[model samples]
Target: MIKKEDDFFSDMYQSINRAFADVIKEFGGFEISKKGFGFNPNFDIKEAEHDYVIKAELSGMDEKDVEISVEENLLKISGEKKEEISDKKGKYHVSERKFGSFERSFTLPPEIDSSKIKASFSKGVLSIHLPKNEKANTKKIEIKTE
Candidate 1:
């Protein structure tokens, strides 16, 4: 029941959608590593008695481009990196660093207080501090009933 005009418009819609996605990539902030590229975000995730800490090296990303979210026990980090110069034209000598959308995640412990987590971005690094819940911080002592 689809008409030719409807099909044409649908194709247009898809094209426009792709353009918008490009715009998002340009300004949306960090680029996740492309498939088959052996590069990762390069982060350090560590656990302490209180909570877990994550440090990520996002060298070229601004504050607005990175997105961090925690759902249940999963912590997600996503962002885009805007290439310094896009006017490649025809002059290219060396291209090494990869650029695009990137995402990383860690499995957080159940005791983490996601709501109270603190994040600070400086230079090209993003440091996050997650504090444990009060109950998780205290040691439990079992009492024997005689």
Candidate 2:
């Protein structure tokens, strides 16, 4: 049995509202989610006595395509992934991989030496190691009597 036109319209209206809400939340900022398509809003960061380590999972990506950088206390990760398969051509199939440019930024501690940061990508993971500045080490003090 077919439903009434008003009922169908109401359902469509709700769906549209939810889609709009998603865009607003994405643009205005919202809590991070690990599911579905979209950028990873948050990444795991750890701090050691000697360095600040940042690691992110980026599967189906090549090491040559990623770019990592830090400016002052901010760190940014960006990359583009393409959709290509070497063999088998067909239509009407399930595809769940995301392909596009992604960017993520984080504010690091003041003691991190941005110039000394090292980045490496391996086995579908990207790691950034920011070693503490040379000044972070203890300095000698001189006592003077006047």
Candidate 3:
């Protein structure tokens, strides 16, 4: 009787799984997976009196792997996260870490002084300082009688 009950439950489970699979196939087999995809890093942008600052959180990455550049009025930041190799040979039950190349671009304001921009990376964080053009500062003009 115990054997019969186990077989019955196993058959029922298989049947349900088949039914679900058939439904998914009928709906064009929609699947969602994040494996082997580039991950986006969090960024913060701040505007100061004389400059703008951009900070990005890029953990598990080295400074040499990242690149920053500006062209015209656009600022682009790109980097890659490489997967580490293990010396020991073993099967992995579950792997959730993301590793790939990522690129992010921002449209810089005309007031920014692209020639004076500076960037630094430390502790897995990237900081960019965009100085404003001296002439871009607000100035008050007195009206004269014509």
Candidate 4:
């Protein structure tokens, strides 16, 4: 009798799980994976009087692992986070950390002087300073009425 009850509950649980996955697929047009996703860092952009500052939070990453470049008006940031090897004898009950390569790009304004841009990394945070061209700064014009 106990075996029959266990089988019934197991069947019900699998049916419910399939129904949930079907609903998610119907709405999102994609199936959820059990593996996991890549590591994408969060960023913040701030504008100052003469320059724009971009900061990216990349925890558990070294400065050498990250790369920054500019092509035309696009600024690109790419990096890889390697996973550590664990003990073969140990078993993991829950693993939630994500490790992989990620790339992010942003379009820079025409007034920005890319040649003079500067970058610094400290405490897992990367900061890029984009200075604006003085000649390209916005100017006000006075209109004469006839």
Pairs that clash in candidate 4? none
Q: Give the TM-score of candidate 3.
A: 0.66
Question: What would the per-residue lDDT of candidate 2 be over residues 1-146, giving only the tens digit for each residue?
Answer: 43433556546766776777798798996634322133342367887778878888888788887888777688878877766665656553444455666777788778888878888889888888989887776567999999
lDDT of 3 at 38: 41
Candidate 2 Cα lDDT to native: 0.71
lDDT of 4 by residue, 1-146 (tens): 12432456546766776788899988986764322125678899999878999999888889999999999999999888888887778666656566778888899999999999999999989999999999877678999999
TM-score of each: 0.63, 0.61, 0.66, 0.67
Tens-digit lDDT string for candidate 1 (1-146): 32433456546766776777777799975543232122246799787888878898888788788899988888888888766777747755555565567788788888888899988899989989999998999787999999
User: What lDDT score is found at residue 85 in candidate 1?
Assistant: 76
RMSDs, each prediction?
Answer: 12.2, 9.4, 11.4, 9.6
User: By lDDT, is 2 or 4 better?
Assistant: 4
lDDT of candidate 1 vs native? Answer: 0.76
Candidate scoring better on TM-score of 1 and 4:
4
* Over 4 Å off, model 2: 1-42, 85-88, 134-146
